[model samples]
Every structure is written in C-alpha cells, then in structure tokens.
Target: MNLYSAVSKSPHRSGTCGPNYLQRLLRLDSPGTQTILSGPESKAMTHYLRSQHDVIIVGVGTAVADNPALNCRIEGVGLKGQPRPLIIDPSGRWEVESEKGLAECVRLAEEGVGKGPWVFTSLAAPKRNQKWSQALDKVGGAYISIPSSDIDGKKDLDWSKILEKLAQLGMSSVMIEGGGSVINTLLQEKYLHLIDSVMITIAPVWLGQGGVVISPPRRADASGQAIPAARLHQTKWQQFGDDVVMCGRIKQ
Candidate 1:
C-alpha cells in the first residue's frame, strides 16, 4: 500500500481536504477509508478528534470495514467524557454474529471506558433486519430510528436531519469518519455550511481499481450531469508520522 507512488502521481488541484482530494488519491467516493490510511498517523488523528468532538460518526460501510472502537485508543491521552460512537447504518446490514458487529461496543460499555455505540438505521429497513436492531439493544447500544418513511432509497439520511437530531440528543459537535460515498454525499448535498473543519490524511498507498472511489453514480439532475464542487477556507497541511494531514475550514 505505498500511497506515495500511487497518490502522489494524482494530486488534487484544490489543495483542500475533502472528497476531491480523497478521490484523486484513493479513488473512493465514500467514507470507508481506514484500510488505505497509515496506522500510527491515522489512529493518532482519530484519537484527537474523538477526544475533541462530542460525537464521532461513520457511515455503515466504515463501521463494517473498520469495526473500530471510536474512543481515543491511546493509553495516556484521554478526554474528560468519551465521545459517543455514531454509525449511519441506514440499512441495518451489520450482523450480530459478525466480528465487526456491536461486540466491541458492548465490551467497552461493560468496561466503563466508553458509552456503547449508537446505530442509526432507516425506518424502512427490511423487517428481517429487526433482529440486528434487537441485538444492538441487547448489547446496550442505542438504536435511532430515523424518520424516512417518505423515501425508501439510499439518500434517506439528510444532513440537516442528522445534525438536528444529534443536537436534540445533546451533541454539540461531531466528527465524521467515513467511506468515499458518504464523503461524496456530503459534498453533493452541500453539507459544508454545517461543518466547521475538514481534516484528511493521505497515506502512502494507492488502492487503484482494487478499492472504491468517492463519486457514486448519482441520478442525473435537470442541470445535466453537473458534478457539484466546493472549496475550503483557511487551508493548511502538516506531517503526521508518514502521512500528510490536510486541514481546512469548510467554506460557506
């Protein structure tokens, strides 16, 4: 996974941190990004965000790919109150028996190190998936039924709806850790207005065709296949171990 040779050859022109940069490097259009990222540098960045934000969020793809414990993993560095793990599992695909299931979250809750993860599934999830929801509850994890009866398709979790719901639940801020599709959705939906900071890590690996990209084949609009684009404000970058951590403020 030498990201340098793979990604350096295809650099982003915006010099901003977001899906375009991610696509240029990793060719992924969603949030499932942990695999291509560097271990030490990536975890350190994840820990810092978990410590800072009130909540940490990942799309379901990421949840399955990483099965990551959202809390700060480092031993000594810790936050006063742990950031809650929030997964956008709209389809309820995580099986109870899977290794990356809610098992780790249950363990953490039992150990008192962090609160159990919150699983957000669409209200219209298949009736058969109810078992998974029940399993999440059985493990002390919370299930949030997002109100999306109007639509049954993939774009059920509107950005504003998610943010407002999190706010109502007492979350002041959130950090989005994700796969490329999720990141691409945020860009296409213009979620930048609600966001404060944008952070990205470019590792030394190029997944190429073996991996996914951030651009999903969204339904064409009347505007005729125009892909939305955005720019970041107050951009900056620095080295984090072997990775390049790109940081910026989302431009309005």
Candidate 2:
C-alpha cells in the first residue's frame, strides 16, 4: 500500500509528529500557511484504482455529497485510464440536492469519461420526490437491486451475493471511497481487504469532536479486545509544500 499526503510548502520542516503537534506550534490565523499537495495523492489514488480495481464503489452519500466526476485526472500529476463507477443507493433515493460548484452526482454524469456511471438501487422507479433513481436511469446508467428477502433473519449482509453480482458484471476488484456510515458497515462485515488513506496535518485548527472522515471502531471481541487487529503494512512520508503526507497500508 502506498500512502501520500497533500500539504503546503514552507521554509520550516516538520517531520512525523502526533496529531496534536500542529496545534501546539503554528498560528492558525495565517491565511495561506497551510499547504495541500492535492496533485500527487490524487494521481496516486487514480492510478491505484485504475490498475487494481475493476469497479469503484461509493456510497450514495459520497455521490450526493461529493458529486465527484470520479474520472482519472491528476491536476498536476497528469492523466491516465479511468475505471468503472459503482454507486450503492439501496433505497433508490438520492437524498442531496445539487448545488452549483459543489461535487454532485449530476456533475459526475456530465463529465464522466470512459465507462460512465452505474448505480445500484432497490427501487424500480421514483416515488414522489425521490427521483434520484429515475435520474440515474435517465442518464443511461444501469441499476441493480438486491432482493430484500435474501437477508431474511440473517445477521450479516450477504456480501457473497454482492460480490457475485459484481463479478458477473466484470468487476474483479472494488475500491470503496466513503462517508463514515458506509465505511462502518463494510468494516463491521469484515469485507474490506485494504484501506489507503492520505493523512495530512494542518497548522492551528483542531476540532476535538466533529465530522470524521472514517468511522466504525476497529473490531473488538467479547474479551474487550480488538479482533483482527490492523497491522501497518507500509508507511511513506513526503513533503508537499508546507504539509507532510503519510501514506500507510493495512495487512488484510
């Protein structure tokens, strides 16, 4: 696994430090003090997905919230082949409204190159104001529904079935980028084989508790111990302007 950080460039050099190190040192008031090296990380992720994953799986929240084009383009890093896009909208409803200049599903539909977009939803058609499903259909994307009855009295989601479906559609590997809840569900089910994260540190700003990028506590056992503890596979450090990027991989 390759980990990369997107940070700003600065004259001062700060190496690998804990989460609290930034707040204790720099001033938060400076407008352009924080540097984000979005180029390299974005390029790395795109390349990894294109090379390894046959499909890209994202939760509806990511689609509605980020509205990412989900294409392969590295702003400064360059461009490469694109991968197929898969959205998991179990209810066939898209909850977020599109805002101008914000990431949205519509934007992705418009700019998506190569394989276009494919949505997975349970609804056959739109009901009332829940028209996201219909919109997806209108865009010429395919939708898949997992029969609700398949989970009857089952504690675990039938990931085997999901994998089978993806396999049938020619998806060998899946890269899941997500909102917290989706990440939690996948982790809970022990379905995720790999995680690639770009950890960045910014000066001054630190919010104790708020929105988290990743969620679901590392699995724990009945003995109050963590089950299947995650082990670090690799770590890479690089300076992007003022910030440092830490890339790590977890052994499956």
Candidate 3:
C-alpha cells in the first residue's frame, strides 16, 4: 500500500510555522484574498489529488475544524472515482448525527455522487457510543473499531492496523489531509517510514504564531544530540497560481 499525505500551510516571516489559515480564510466570503491567493486553482489541485487517490483520511480534529466535503469535485469524475473518506477518531468522539461534514458524506453517498465515510474508532468506543455506530449504519457507512495502543501513556490508533483495514477494503493508496496533530504524529520517528510521499502547498501569506502548525516531531539521540531535520528525496516544486506546491518522498 502507498501512503501519501498532503497539506497546505502558511509560514511566518520569521520562518515559524502556522496552520492552513489560507484555506480557512478562503472559505470565508471575506474581502482580502482576491488578488493574493489563487483559491480556485489551489483547490482544483487538491481535488485533482483526491481524484488520484483511493482513500482520503483525516483525524477527528480536522473532521471537526474544517467540516470538509471530502469529495473530488473535479469535472466528470463520477461516483466510482470518488475516494473513500476515512476518519481516525480513536475515541469515537465525532458526532456524526450533527456534523455537517459527515452529513454531506452521507448525502453524497445516497445520491450516488460519492461514498459515505468509514470511521475508525477504538474497540471500546462502540460500547461507549452506540449512537455513533447506529448513525453510521443508518447512512450505510461503516463504524470500524480497532484496538488502541498506549503512546506516551495516552491511547493512540495504530497506523499499521488502520492501513491493514483500508487494504482489506481494497484501497491501495491513501492521501492524508489533516489537522496539525495527525500530520505531526505520522511524521514522528515511530511512524515516519510508513509515509511513501508528501505533497505540501505553501501559501504566500504568513499566519504567525497564533495558529496551528504542522511540524515533524523532534527527537534527540541517547547522548541528547538533536536529530537532523526530516528530508525529502526527489523534491519538486510547482506553482499553483499564487501558492507553491512541493512534492517529494521521505528520504528513508
């Protein structure tokens, strides 16, 4: 299975990191981004990427914050080409009954325009929230429960198990678009190798320190020497209107 992740971010002037404020900003009908960012082109690239992948995965945080449609909107790509939407909600915290995003997923599925979501939750989550499972079942969606493992004493989903589940569903490729923590966790030393490639869209504006940032987890050697920054091989950059898209594979 090939696992790929894509993100769009704006960096601060001081080289600090920030969130996808550009995306959020563009989502609003506010004045400001008209001349600076090419919103349509950037979004088209994202949808095109979605059309190319078999599944799209997002953490519950993103599923909440963005309320994304999670479907490929490119012209003429019918239901069969639509990537499967998957959410990694370890505790089944996502409220599918009220979440407009998953609601849209259900709508798309029923209308034959896209597929419903496949939510991954902890084994215990179903027992805790039978309503969540029931809601998914009502929409012909899946409520998959996998065992959780301890990471730093906190429960975390195992990516390997999740990938195996996706594989069982016949999905060969996955594209991860996210909220900060999910991206950061996958880039950590423990799971970094699972990623086959990464594509990032760099927006022109600086979002400063007040926003969420996507960064690889930092670690040190046994002697306390800091490890080098993560690197990508075959890195390539292309302009998507005002934003620059960088594509590369992990340098493992």
lDDT of 2 by residue, 129-229 (tens): 34544555554455676443233243322344455566566554555544444455544435344233423333233444333333445666688887764
In model 3, residue pairs whose N, Cα or C atoms come closer than 3 Å (at least 3 residues apart or on different chains), thus clashing, are none
Candidate 3 ranges with C-alpha deviation above 4 Å: 1-22, 25-38, 99-102, 126-134
TM-score of each: 0.72, 0.57, 0.82
What are the Cα lDDT values of the candidates? 0.57, 0.44, 0.65
**True lDDT of residue 170, candidate 3:** 66
Estimate the lDDT of model 3.
0.65
Clashes of 3: 0
**Of 1 and 2, the candidate ranking higher by TM-score:** 1
Question: Residue-wise lDDT of candidate 1 within 1-252, one digit each (tens)?
Answer: 000000122111111222223332333455345344455655555565566566666667655655566676657654356767777877777554464444565567557677677877777766545665566566466778776533335446766666667766767667666555556666553444555566766777666564655553454457787544655668677787777777776555
lDDT ranking of the models:
3, 1, 2
Clash count (model 1, backbone only): 22
RMSD of each: 8.4, 10.2, 7.0
- Over the full model, what C-alpha lDDT does candidate 1 score relative to the true structure? 0.57
The true-structure Cα RMSD of candidate 3 reads 7.0
| Candidate 3 C-alpha lDDT tens digits along 150-170 | 777888898767777676666
For model 1, how big is the CA root-mean-square deviation? 8.4
